[model samples]
Target: MPQFAELRRRVIQGGEAHFITSLTRCVRWAQRGGKSNAYFAKTRDDRFIIKSLNKAEKASFLRFAPAYFEHMVKMLSGQRTCLAKLLGVFTVTFKPTAGGGLSAATGSSSGPNEGLDLLVMENSFYGRP
Candidate 1:
């Protein structure tokens, strides 16, 4: 995840703190005509966009992730590519608490407690005038 950390540090203002803070406050982002039932949310800080992906989409991305990192290293022209700067992909799940309650905190996105598969990318409109 060093490459991912590099991407985060390069594009964001701070480290993990900034990222967590950004996600702490987000608003539902409107759909711009996609055929999937994915959910979209824009960080209130306006630095990133979170898209919930289906199982199939998530699997597809994971399959080509190694190649993606390779290709990203070649993005040196400072121009936006067709694919936005994808920061990371992960799942956020809820875990059962000590009291047998589901915690709002994120956990493993797999297993019996299925969670959302998310794609976090740099906000295309970030830093816009």
Candidate 2:
């Protein structure tokens, strides 16, 4: 499996994610809207999508993650047509490196900062764009 560091590097290198080792599928850019950016990834096993929250809006999401997940579960349960589901909620932290670049970290930092929060979701091919 590719570690978070590797994934971060790929993202930073301008490589739009084409695959996710954890999900084990080829990912493609599906759609993006609102304050957060979204993408759809498809595979024979199942279609998945990932939503990356904007850095500026992390605080709002962090505050309501639990409530949002609960509501989603209720609304999406037992829906066969729904190819995507909520897998997990995690925080992707980024820090400014000494070289003036950014590094993707897994937790919050204590020093002065420049980082982002990302919300990952499985893509549902309900209405492919």
Candidate 3:
């Protein structure tokens, strides 16, 4: 967890991801495609992906987050890697508005993503053809 802010700055700057929004977004991913069953959402700007994570998945990441950060420092320090360039490792929640169900989230009546845990990462396919 040391130098986290600096590391984040470097990663974002290196990736030229300054256009990424800083708001607390309740996203609705446009193109949701993955092999897993977890709910996925994309940032409004289409620069990032939000993936719902179960307790197991969350625990798994936390267990390795430190080492991952170390690797990230090395990568940013010049030992480039093919691994994911994580912008953040945090939780997400979709609190319902007073209007009721988040039908706008999926164009349906289901509230599957409500009250779930999530993590945000830079979209690897961003700006790709």
Candidate 4:
């Protein structure tokens, strides 16, 4: 996956309202009326906190979350007035870790295969009425 520094730089340059990491596997209860999964991550300065969503409940989100995030970012930056806005989407790619003794040297893909979709948003935390 991209280093944390790289991701941070992208987020800042993108000028998104918020950077989110999906905590789909962490929290118990759903926020936003179970509309999306949950997530927790630090801000630009590394102050950490928690947020929740219901993303896993929908297949579309799983497939196209990245595209959706990017769309939102463009819309928001344009200063368009809409009921809802999106910021941007970022895909974090990571190198597979090595496992086993010889296999590790062989560069096998047996280690952790993990990735995440970063969904940027503007005014999403303001809550909806």
Candidate 5:
């Protein structure tokens, strides 16, 4: 969470909107990829995709977040590119409920193996008809 706090600061300072995730409202409805070991889900509004990240992937993300953030800033602000913009990175603990919804995590006290690491990206085709 501290890392996210810092990331949020950097994102906003770089002229991008900061996205705060609500795991309670998101639904992980699909799994994708094989060797990549990635699962894909969308926000309830279908505006973003949440991708699961393994430990190594998460580490790589954090290591390059500064450069990635800058790349996103440029790509989103009129630069032409086929790359999807990363909206946020988060670690969340999801305890399943009877209705199949996730219980809210209270704080950042969860251990590394106890939570899900995720990358949030804008859905490039979200507005397509």
Candidate 6:
């Protein structure tokens, strides 16, 4: 997570996100229907989306982080690309629910799961030219 954070900082400083905000202040809304019955939401500013990831997706993101970072560097240098900017990768721990099973939509579990894998990216609704 820290590595990704550092990469994000470098890329943003390199000017890949001149239009991007600090993401320090925003609102969140819960939505439904995503991979592995995960949860999804958009920030109030419409600049970013926070989504839950299943184990496979989490693994894939970590596996591809190096390539993704490289691609962002290339794009930053004016190579032209279409990849979504990955802002952050994180985990949200949830306490077990009374039922002892994870909720398919919210990723909250009734004492059965430890946390939700999360991915944060630039919202597709904004920043297109």
Clash count, one per candidate: 0, 4, 1, 18, 0, 5
Return the candidate ranking by lDDT, descending.
1, 6, 5, 3, 2, 4
Give, for candidate 3, the lowest lDDT window spanning 10 residues.
102-111
Pick by lDDT: which candidate is best?
A: 1
Kindly list the per-residue Cα lDDT of model 5 for residues 8-126, writing each as its tens digit.
45543333342443333577755545578588787776666789999999998889877766675675566777877676777777555567566766554333224788887767887
CA-RMSD of model 1: 3.7
Best by TM-score: 1
**Which scores higher on TM-score, 1 or 5?**
1
- Which residue pairs in candidate 5 collide? none
Q: What is the C-alpha lDDT profile of model 1 across 16-129, one tens digit per residue?
A: 689878888989998788878689999998998999989889889888888887777667446445778888887787765667767655544433564678888888878899
Badly placed stretches (over 4 Å) of model 3 are 1-4, 13-27, 30-35, 93-115
Which candidate do you rate higher for lDDT, 3 or 4?
3
Error of 6 at 26 (Å): 6.5
lDDT of 3 by residue, 8-63 (tens): 57656433345244324547654446666888777665666777788888889889
Cα deviation of 126 in candidate 5 (Å)?
A: 0.3
Report the C-alpha displacement of residue 128, candidate 5, in angstroms. 0.6
